[model samples]
Target: MTKNNALGTNVIAQIGILVHDIEKTSQKYADFFGVEKPEWSLTDTLERAKTEFEGNPTDARAKLAFFDMGSLQLELIEPDQNPSTWRKHLDEHGEGPHHIAFFIEGMKEKIAIMESKQMPLLQKGEYTGGRYAYMDTFKDLKIIMELLENDN
Candidate 1:
């Protein structure tokens, strides 16, 4: 198979963890990282979301904490009762690391390539400046891969 230019060159920019409680989990992460204060992730506040679950439009929310561990970020997500990837992970697998993310430039094209490869989109949502989606890559990678397209 020929390599497509859609995805471009990208790096694993962040690690996401699903948690039962963001406040409690963030503290643990802070302690583990030996930081007195951890920065609030961009998702800490609801940012006018447009979400999808299993290819259908849906609603979801989360409280998140972001830590800058050099070039990589560690994020903790506590999902609300709504149907979402985080909630589903918590229900099926309990609290733990959920996915690794890459920030992409040509997001629309990248998404098409991923779907063409049979890596179906499990969940997706739009935030302030851009959007994010999770690909169900468990059968191959045993973990989810998140693609993020941000305006800032």
Candidate 2:
């Protein structure tokens, strides 16, 4: 890792986009790429996700679909009418790029480093085998940054 690299790695694992209709968007992407449309599914339940938003526990959820493209994955997010980072972005920005994710270790340290850089945590949640956090870096980077730490 470079001394100035707060995220530890320079590789971007995923680029997430917010959409009003994931089904339609996924289909369009599939057609454009000439690949079968991937299934879109809801995120884990609130109980399983243990989601927190703006430092408070939340039941926000969204449907997700992923398309693996070479070294990076394109993530589609269709948020429910709940208060979440995804929902907020979709509502405020009206469907577009949301975040760029990086797989990293030491999530806590990475969060702190980001916070120290004036990028506060916007949301966080746990998935089946890993956890993720969204950092509010849009002002500086033009997009949020998601940190994924998997426990394998």
Looking at model 1, report the run of 10 residues with the lowest lDDT sum.
Answer: 39-48
Across residues 1-152, which tens digit of lDDT does each residue of candidate 1 receive? Answer: 23654456557899999888777878887888798656555342234666788877665777788888999998888888877888889999999989999888777777888888888889888777888989988888899999999996
Model 2, 18-83: lDDT tens digits are 999999999999999999999998888789999999999898999999999999999999999989
| Residue pairs in clash, model 2 | none
> TM-scores across all candidates?
0.87, 0.98
Count of steric clashes across candidates, in order:
0, 0
Clashing pairs for predicted structure model 1, backbone only: none
Best by TM-score: 2
